[model samples]
Target chain A: MIEQYLLHLFIIACVYAILAMSLNLAVGFTGLLNLGHVAFYAIGAYTSALLAVGLGVPFWGGMLAGGCMAALFGYLLSFPTVRLKGDYLVLGTLGFTIIVEAVLKNWASLTRGPLGIAGIPKPRLLGLSLSPLPAYALLALAAALLTYWLLSLVVASPFGRTLKAIRDDEVAAGALGKDTFRAKAKALALSAFLAGVAGALYAHYITFIDPSSFSITETILIFSMVLVGGTASLLGSVAGAALLVLLPEPLRFLPIPSDIVGGMRQAIYALLLVLVILKRPQGLLGEDTLRDAWARARRRRKGA
Target chain B: MDILPQLIMNGLIAGSVYALMAAGFSLMYGLQRFMNVAHGATYLVGAFAAYACARLAGMPLALSFAIAVLVATGLGVAINQLVYVPLQRQKEKDRALLLASFGVFLLVEAIILMVFGADVKSFGLPVRKGMDVLGAVVTPVQLVIILAAPLVFLGLWLFLYRTRTGTALRAAADNEAIARTMGVNVRAMTTLTTALGSALAGVAGILVALEQNLEHSMGLPAVLKGLTAAIIGGIGNVPAAILGGYLLGLAENLGIWYLPSGYKDAIAFVILILFLLVRPQGFFGTRRREEAGG
Candidate 1:
């Protein structure tokens, strides 16, 4: 039974790994502060769920379609926010998430409202059913690895350097003849695509989907993962995702009261977020240890 | 029976509360130059503290309110000192400050949920008879709230324009480097701003708790609407912000008459996006501003 449980955990970690890596492409590398990242996940989940249920599409086709749908919205969302920065950008994205949730909740004819969509067929790949516990572990692992490899390639290419350049200094990047808006939009689209794939994987595995599943909590959780693991690092995304997935596991083994467990987990997450932002803004595995910045701070304080 | 009076009365009540929040919000934004979202948590702290004192401890409502304001004020100043001040000292600090503020917000929200279970709470004040005014039944508490907006605006205007300390605070907010060079004690001014702004938030929280059901998740959405009102009036303009609040409250109430109530938050988002896209400076602002974080 523990074997089954651990395998389940691994599969969930795989999905989170995909989500974290994709989010890192936008927030970590490109500095987007996309508070509506969950919108993409919801879009992907619903898109794949609808395709699978309404048309009997296989797992691969449904998942790809989900990713494409999310990517399209991600690219579209980026255009309006290309010029906004800091707090304005945050508000804009937060509004999008609210709008997405509103639509998902009110469009009862399609989404079934709060009752949610159920009876989703388990994932299938190449005519092989991946519904068994151990089989799902391997399938999720393979999917996560494929995502990692492809994103790693994207992060290492000139395009990745351009994203970092734009993050560090957009005006300079634009001066260098790099189309900043287009590049950032493409990066967001790719990130959303991976998130969509993860969402589809989650939906089929859980065999249910709802609007509440893709709330602001998901955004906070994934954002914390990227920050804790190390921003701008692909491996950090995997590590962060795994760490968060495993963090509250010990709660089940403890003797804490059931009612307080959820609150305790949230408290721990929020505490970690504040600590990480305050103590290590570069994150656990991020580059540039801020030595130069500290020296400047010291000199400034000394009235130099 | 005409429904216009009741709707307008409801709009005025909501608008006044939102204006109080926006006044504090704009002050902090001006002083810190970033959205101090943790200010929203002050509402939670104030309302919860008041509820605990008044209902649980059986204290008088006025005394409970005073204690709540003090606690919220202290918390606000503590956040400014412990969290935001450090971030403000760094280069490329705008994003970090905003995120840190959000982190503090979530941290407080989680703690509140833990301490006060996820249940809707109320102060259980004795119900007062409603008086008919222009075919609408208006309660005493509603009248107080409706009057509070203009009173707060007048008080803020007097303090900012007539007092030497207030002028000094404005100078600091306008340009910190210049203010410091002029020996303005910019840090003290910021602390003062936090204290004043948070006290206002505490009052607004108590008003909201009195008129509506109190829940753990109520703070953020209400404050987001306050932020919307602030944006509509232009970020730092006081009179315009108050005007914007009334306008938004009126819009929301009147919009609900035609559409489902579930679309209330959606309406705010639509307005926010439209304003952000078409009129970034808001309706009554002379300054044109945009930043790419460079």
Candidate 2:
């Protein structure tokens, strides 16, 4: 029983790790303070769920469609709003998330209102259903590892350097002849794609999907995971996800009332977020990504 | 009774409350570049404070309102001191400040939920007959709101234009470094700005609670509407924010005439996105130099 519980926790951690890493690309790498990252996650989950449950599509096909749909939305959203800098950009992203949630809740015909879609079929490999906790855990683990590897490669590529440049100073990056807008759009699309995949995995694993699961709180949770783990560090994303996923689990064993537990967990996260941002903005596992980048740029100028 | 007049009156009432919120929000945004997500929490605190004072402590209605505004102002200033000040001192990134504010918002919200349960609370104000205004029925409390909003705006305008502290705040908003060099206490000005802004939010919250009901989750929607109004008016422009608030109120109310009432919440977001994409400088805001990126 203990092992089974551990596996369940592990799967949740893996799902959150993918979310954190995807958010890290926009927030950590590209300097986009996207408060609406979970919108794309919802988009992906709904797309996949509808396709698999309604159209009888395979899991792989649904996942691909989910990623593409979310990416399309990312590109469409970023094309116009990417030029906005700082807090304005943050508001723009936040507006997107609120709209997405409103649509999901109000569009009864499509999302079934608040009732939510259920009985999502499990993933099947070679006509063999991966329904057991252990099999699903392996699937989630593989997806998380793949996401990390792919994201690491992206960050190490020339595109990654350009993103860092833009993050540090968009004007300087522009002066150097980089298409900063296109780069930001691409980054947003890629980030959305990854988040969508994570959403797909979550849908299949949980076997239930609802609009409530993709609220602003979930976005904040993923964001906190990124910040607490260490922005701009793939490993930090994994560790942060694991830590947070496990942090509240021990509280279940406590004699506290179930109703208060949810609020307590959120309070703990809020405290951690405030403390981390104030005391250790570099986070626990990685260097201060944006500040260090700015410092490095300053040092380079001084050297010149 | 003409439905048009009723809708227009209803819209104006809603607009007046949003104007209060937007004006304060715009004032703070003008000075501090970061959006304080905790602004909503402060509003909630104010509403709940009034609720607690009136229902639990059995304070007089007027006294409870005053106490609520004071508490909100204190909470706002405290948040700035505890969260934003330390990060500013460290020269932390804007994202950090934003995240910290979000954290504070969540923390305060959870605390409010814990203390006041998740159930919605009401002020239990005594019911009175609705007065007819221009062929439309208006509640006494709503008339008070309508009358009070303009008075508050005028008071704020006079304070900003005629008072010494207000001038210092304007100076800081124009250029913080220059304001500091010119003997303006930048720190004190920020604290004052937060207090005033939060007090406005508090008033808006109380008025809203008196009109409707109070829920812990009301903060986010209130903040969003205020934000939409501020952005539509042009960020940092007080007069424009007020105008935007009225405009948003009208648009939202009239919009439900054509579409489902459920889409009422979405109208603000749509307007926000449209403004962000088409004219981010908004109705009165000058195009910022930084926005002109390559």
Candidate 3:
């Protein structure tokens, strides 16, 4: 039983790691400040869930479809709101999430409203169903490694460096002849595509898809993991996901009301987030020198 | 036509409450230039505190309201001292402050859930029948809100424009360094401003509770709406905040009549996006910072 639980945790953490890493592309590298990122997650989850559960499509096909759909949505959304900066973008993304949530809740013809879609078929490799604990864990592990390798490559590529440049200073990048809009659009599309694939995997793994499962609060949690791990490092997002996803299960052993227990666990997480931000805003692995330089520049500008 | 009057009356009452809430939210943002997401938590707590005092302790309505305001104000001050002030002093990352505030919001919300549970509570105040005003129904509470909201706005405007303390706050908001150089205790002003702003939110919460049920999740919507109003009217514009609040309230209420009720939140976002695309500085906001700096 203990081993089974650990396997379950491992599977869940791998999925979250995928999510955190994809989010890091937009939030960490691009500095887009998207507060409603879970919309794509929902889109991917619903797309894959409907395909596998309703249309009887296989898991791999559903995953690809889900990712493509999310990317399409991301590209479309980026066109209108690309010019917004900081809080404006935050509000826009938040608005996008709300709209998606409304559609998910009200459009019962497709999503079945709050009843949700369940009993999704797990992935099969070579006509052998890998639905068991050990098999699922292995599958998730492979996905995590693949995602990590791909993300590492992207962040290392010149295109990825362009995203970082835009994040650092869009105006400066523009002055240096880089099309800031094109860079941001590509970053957003890539981030959404990754998040969509993660959602597809999550939907198949959990065998259920519900609107409540992908909420603004869930987005916050995902964002928190990215922040806690510190941005700009593949290792950090995976570590954050593993730590956060697996931390609270043992606390259920304590003799407390389920509600209070959930509340307490969230409180502890919140406290940790507060402490991390207060002490080290750049995150765990962030270079303090760069942060200091930015601070100094802002201060000098203010003084002037 | 009759429905029109009723909608207008309902919109005015709803807008009045929103105006009060946005006034508090905008004042703090103008002074500090940080979105205190935790203010929503304070609003929720204030409503629950009033509910507890009124229903559980059987206190008088006025006394309950006062206690709620005081508690929320104290909590706001405590937050400034414990969380916000420390971070500001350290001069940490801007997003760091936002994340910390989100954490605090989560913490306070969790605590409220633990203490109050998820059940909605009400004060069961004496429900006065609505009076027919030009073929529209207006409850006494709505009337009071309409009258009191503008009075509060007037008071705030007078305080900001006519008083020395108000001038100090405006000066600090406009240029914190210059204000500090001019011997304004910038820290004290920010603290006071935060406390006062949150207390006003507490008042708005109570007023909102008088009309709607008080629940743990109330703060989230209030924060969103208040922030929308502030952003629409320009982040730091006081009078614009009030105007934006009324506009949002009317737009939302009338939108439910014209469009589907499900799109209520969507309407606010559409307006927000429009403002972002067209007039980022807001209706009455000066292009001081954007022009001077950017």
Error of 2 at B226 (Å): 1.1
What ordering of candidates by lDDT runs from best to worst?
2, 1, 3
What is the per-residue lDDT of model 3 for residues B28-132, given as tens digits with 9 covering 90 to 100?
A: 987777778888877877888888898899998899999999999998888888888778766434666677778888888889877877677776768889899
List the candidates' TM-scores in order: 0.94, 0.95, 0.93
lDDT of 2 by residue, A31-103 (tens): 8888878999999999999999999998999999999999999999896678787777878888889889889
Question: Which window of ten consecutive residues has the lowest lDDT sum in model 1 chain A?
Answer: A283-292
**Runs of candidate 2 exceeding 4 Å displacement:** A288-304, B291-294
lDDT per residue for candidate 3 within A60-125, as digits (tens), equals 999999988998888877876777766667777887887788788878889998889989889999
Query: Model 1: per-residue lDDT, tens digit, B1-294?
Result: 899889988888888888888888878877888878887899888888889888889999899999999999999999998988878766658877887777788778877887887878877878899988778898888887887768878888899889999999989987889998998998899999999889888888888888777887777886788888888888877677778888888888888898788787788888888887777677885554554222
DockQ of each candidate's interface versus the true one? Answer: 0.52, 0.62, 0.43
> Candidate 1 docking: what grade?
medium
Deviation (Å) of B141 in candidate 1? 2.9
- DockQ of model 1, rounded to 2 decimals: 0.52
Predictions: Cα RMSD each: 3.4, 3.4, 4.4
Query: What is the descending DockQ order?
Result: 2, 1, 3
Model 2's interface RMSD: 1.8
The window of 10 residues in a row where model 2 chain A has the poorest summed lDDT is A284-293
Better of 2 and 3 by DockQ: 2
